[model samples]
Target chain A: MLHSFTIHRAAALLRAGEISATELTAAVLDRIYAVDNAVKAYLTLLPEVALAQAAAADAAIAAARAAGTLADLPILTGIPLAIKDVITVAGVRTTCGSKILESYIAPYQAAVVDRLAAAGAVILGKTNTDEFAMGSSTENSAYFTTHNPWNLDRVPGGSSGGSAAAVCADECLAALGSDTGGSVRQPAALCGVVGIKPTYGRVSRYGLVAYASSLDQIGPLAKDVTDAAILLGAVAGYDPRDSTSVDLPVPDYVGVRDQGAGDRGLHGLRIGVPREYFAPGMQAEVEGAVRAAVELMAELGAEVREVSLPHTDLALPVYYIIAPAEASANLARYDGIRYGLSAPADSLWEGYRRTRGQGFGAEVKRRIMLGTYALSAGYYDAYYLKAQQVRTLIKQDFELALQDVDVIACPTSPTTAFRIGEKVDDPLSMYLSDVFTLSLNLAGICGMSMPCGFDAAGLPIGLQLIAGAFAEATILRAAFAYEQATAWHKQKPAPG
Target chain B: MSLTIAEVEHIAELAKLGLTDAEKALYREQLSAILDYAATLQAVDTSAIPPTATGLPLRNVMREDAVRPSMPREDVLANAPDASEGYFRVRAVFESGD
Candidate 1:
C-alpha cells in the first residue's frame, strides 16, 4: 500500500516516476476513511487540502524531471504526513484537543508547516492531543481518546497519541508531533514507531499552541529512523520569530547516519545506560528487552557503560512544577476578551472565570490550579524557584554524564502502552508514566525512541537513545545502527 | 501538604477559573497529592545551586527594529468571539455604579 511506504522509499519511487503524489495521498485518505473511526487519530482530516497539495507536488516534480534536476529535489517531496493538533496550519481548525478552539481556524501556520510545504510534503490533517498537551494518556483530550494501534484497549501514549497512532496504523507515512515531557517519544514508543524529540531551540516553535514554553519542542514520528531524520531535517532550523530558536546550521542527519555506518554497526560508539532509568516498577519484560538491546549494541562494538544521572528521580516533580507554571502563564491569553470560547457573564472577571472553567478539561484545570498555586504570592520561592534550582542539578547531571558517554540509552517509557482509563483517575500515576522521558526535556537535550522488542502479549517496547543538545546526529546514528541490526522496526500492528 | 477548600477556591479565583464546588474539592485533593509528591524535591541539596529558568544558553535575543508588514486585521480578528471595527469586544470591567 502507498500509505505503508516510508518517506524515503516513497520519495525514491516518486523521483523514479513510478508513482505520483496524488496516488500516494489518495491511498492514505482511503486508509484514514477505512480505519479512523476505530483509531480516532485525527481530529480533522483535510482530504481536499491534501489532494490540492499533492497536485502541486506532482507539478513541481514533473517540472524538475523535465529539467533533469529531479535529484536536486527535497527528500520529503510528495510525502504525506499527519500533524499534531497543537501545531497550527493556516485556515485549518487547530483544537489542541480542547473545546475552546473547537471551531477556531489558525490565523497563521507553524514554521514546521511552512518548511514541510517548501519540501513538497502533503499534510493529511490535524491529529488529536492531550488537551493543551497536558496529559500522558490521550484520555485527557476533550473530544475523544486515541486508541493504541497495537491493542485497541490500550492508550496510544500521549499527548501526541493521535500522531503516533496515525503512523502505526498506516493512516499516514509519517507525522509531526510536539514533545514536552515525552509527548512525542512516549507515544511513538507505545505505538511502535520511531519518534524524535529534537533539542530545544533546534526547531522553531512559532505557531505551536503553547503548553510549556521552556520544555516544548516539535519533532517527528515515522516508520523508521531514516524517515524521522528526514522529517526532522525538513522542519529544523532557526526562525527569527521564535526568540528561543537557536541560530545554528542543521546537520545533515541522514548523511551522518548513512555515511558508511549502516554496515559499520555502532563500532566505537559510546552508549550510556543510566542505572536510575531501570529502577523499580519498570516492567520486567521492558527492562529485559532494553537490556538485551544494550547487550546487542555492545556486541556490535558499542562501548556500553553504566552511567549515573543521580537527579533522575526528581525530573517528574520538577517537570510538573515548571511545565504547569509556564502553562498557566501561557494559557492566560485564552480569556474571553480574545479568540476561543467565550462564556457569558455580567462582568469581565466573571467572564474570564466562566470561559476558562467551561473551556478547559479537568486535567487542564488541575494543572492550571497547580501552576497558580505554585506561582502565587508567598509560594513562588518554595515551588517554582525550588524546581528551577533542582532543574539546574538535573541539567548538570546530564552534562557530567555525557562527558563520559556519547549517548544515553534507556527504555522510552516505564512500560509498554497501558490500558485506556488505567491511570486517568490518578493523576500522579499518569505522571509517573513519563518519568523515564521527562529528564531530557528538563536538560533540553535530544532523544529518539524506536522499537526495541515486543512483550509476550505482542505489545511493542521502545528503546530511547538520548544525546546532548544539538547532537541529534549522534542519537540518529546510534538508532540507525541499532535499527539496521534488528527487525523490530519492521513489525506492524493489526489495530482492532 | 493538603490544601483547604478555601485555599482551592482562592487559587481558582486567582487563575480566573469558575469551578463548581465539586471540581474545587476534587482539585484540592488532587493538587494536594501532587504537591505532596513534589515535596520530595525539598530533600535535594540545592542551596548552592543557581536556578535555571531555561535550559538553553540564550539571553536578550534582540533583532533589528524595522518596519514590517503585519497580519491583516481581518485575519487577526477572524477567530474572535466578538469583533467590531477590528477590535475585540468583551464584558465590562467595572459596574456603572462604581
Candidate 2:
C-alpha cells in the first residue's frame, strides 16, 4: 500500500514518475479516514491543507523533472508526515493537547515547520500530545487518549504518543515529535517504530511551545532508520531565531549513511552496555529481547563492553525537578489576557488564577505546583539548584562513558506498552516508565529507539542507541546496521 | 515530606492557579509523594559542583540587529481574549475609583 511506503521509497517512486504526490497523499488520507476513529492519533486532520501541499509538491516535481534538475530536489518533497500538536503551524489550530490552547490559532509557524515546507513536505495534520507535553501517557491530553496501533487496550507511550502511534499505524510515512525526558523515544519504543531524540540544540525549539526549555528537543519518529535519517537531515541545522540552536554545520546524515553502506557490518564499533539501564523489576521478555539484540551487535563484529553510569539512578529526580521548574516559568505566559482560554473574573488576578486553574489538566497542574514549590523562595537552593548540580554529574557520566565507547546500547523502556489507565492515577509509577531513556536528554546527547524484537503478546521492544552530542550519524549507522541484520524494522501493526 | 492542604494552596497561589479544595487535597498528596521521591537528590553532595542550566555551552546568542517584517498587529491581537484599537485590552491594573 502507498500508505506503508517509507520516505525513501516514496521519494524514489515520485522521482521515477511512477506515482504522483497527490495519489500517495490520497492513499494516506484514505487510510487515516479508515483507521483514525479507532486509533485517535490526530487532534486535527489537514486533508485540505495536505492535498494542497501535495499538489504543490507535484508541480515542483514536474518542473524539476522538465528542467532535468530532479536530483537537486530534497528527499522530503511530497512525503506526507504528521506533526505533534506542540509545534505551531500558521493558520492552523495548534492545541498542544491542552484546553488552554484549544481554540488557539498559531499566528506564525515554527522554524521546523518552515523547514519542512521549504523541503516540499506535505504535512498531514497535528497529532495528539500530553497537555503542554507534560505526561508520559496521552491520557493527560485534554482531548482523548491515543490507542496503541498494536493493541488498542495498551498505551502508545507518550507525550509524543500520538505521533508514534500514527507512524506505527501507517497513517503517515514519518512524524515529528518533541522530546522532553522520554516523550519521543519511549513512545517510539512502545509503538514499535523508530524515534530519535537528537542531542539538545540539534533541532530548533523556536515554536515548540516550551515544556522544559533545557530538556525539550524535536526529533523524528519513522518506520526505519533511513527515513529517520532523511527527516532529521531536513529539519536539523542552525536557526538564527533559536538562541540555543548550535551554529555548527549540520551533518548530511543520508549522505553519510550512503557512504557507510559499504561497511554496514558493525566492524570495530565499540558498543557500551550500560549496566544501570537494565534495572530490576523490568519485564523479563523486554530484558531478554534487548540483551539478545546487543549480542547480535557483538556477533556482527562490534565490541561490547559493560559500562556504568553510577549516578544513573538519580536522573529521574533531577529531570522531574529541572523540567517542571522550567515549565512553571514557560507556562506562565498563558494568563487570561493572552491567546488561548480566558475565564473572566471580577479582578485580574482572580481571572489569571481561574483561567490557569481551569485550563491546565491534572498532570500539568501537579507539575506546575511541584515546580512552584521547587523554585519558590526558601526551597530554590534545596530543590532546583541541587537538581542542577546533580544534572552536571549525570552529564559528566555520559561524557566519561562516551570517551571509550562509540554508542551505548540499552532497552528503550523497562517494559513494552502498558494497559491504558494502568498508571494514570499513579504519577510516580508512570515516571518510572522512562527510566532507561531519560538520561540522554539529561546529558544532552543523542539517542534513538528502534524495534529489536516483540514480546510474547506481540508488543514491540526497542533497543536504544546513545551517542555523543551531534553524533546522530553514529547512532543512525549503528541502528541501520542492526536493522539490516534483522527483520524487526519491517514489522508493522495490523490495521486498527 | 507530606504536604498539607495549606501548603498545596500556597504553592498553587504562587503559581497563579486557583484550585478547588478537592484539587488542593489531591495535589497535596501527589506533589508530596513526588517531592518525597525527589528528596533523594540531597544524598548526592554537590558542594563543589557547579550547576548546569543549559545543555550547550553557547550563551547569549545574538542575531544581527536587522529589522525584519513583524507579525501584523491585527493578526497578533486576533487571538487575544480582549482587544481594543491596535492593542491587547486588559482589565485596569488598579480598580476604578481607587
lDDT of 1 by residue, A161-193 (tens): 999999999999999999999999999999999
Top DockQ: which candidate number? 1
Error of 2 at A308 (Å): 0.7
True contacts kept of each: 0.87, 0.84
Assign candidate 2 its CAPRI class: high
Instruction: In angstroms, give how far residue A6 of model 2 lies from its true place.
Output: 0.5
Going through the candidates in order, their DockQ values are 0.88, 0.87
Candidate 2, residues A1-496, lDDT tens digits: the string is 9999999999999999999999999999999999999999999999999999999999999999999999999899999999999999999999999999999999999999999999999999999998999888799999999999999999999999999999999999999999999999999999999999999999999989999999899999999988999999889988878889987788888776676579668887899999988888999999999999999998878999998899999999999999999999999999968699999898889999999999999999988998989999999999999999999999999999999999999999999999999999899999999988888898899999999999999999988999999999888878878888899988888856
| Candidate 2 C-alpha lDDT tens digits along B26-69 | 89888989999999999888999999997788768666788899
How far is B1's C-alpha from truth in model 2 (Å)?
Answer: 1.0
Which pairs in model 1 have colliding backbones? none
RMSD of each: 0.9, 1.0
lDDT of 2 at A245: 91
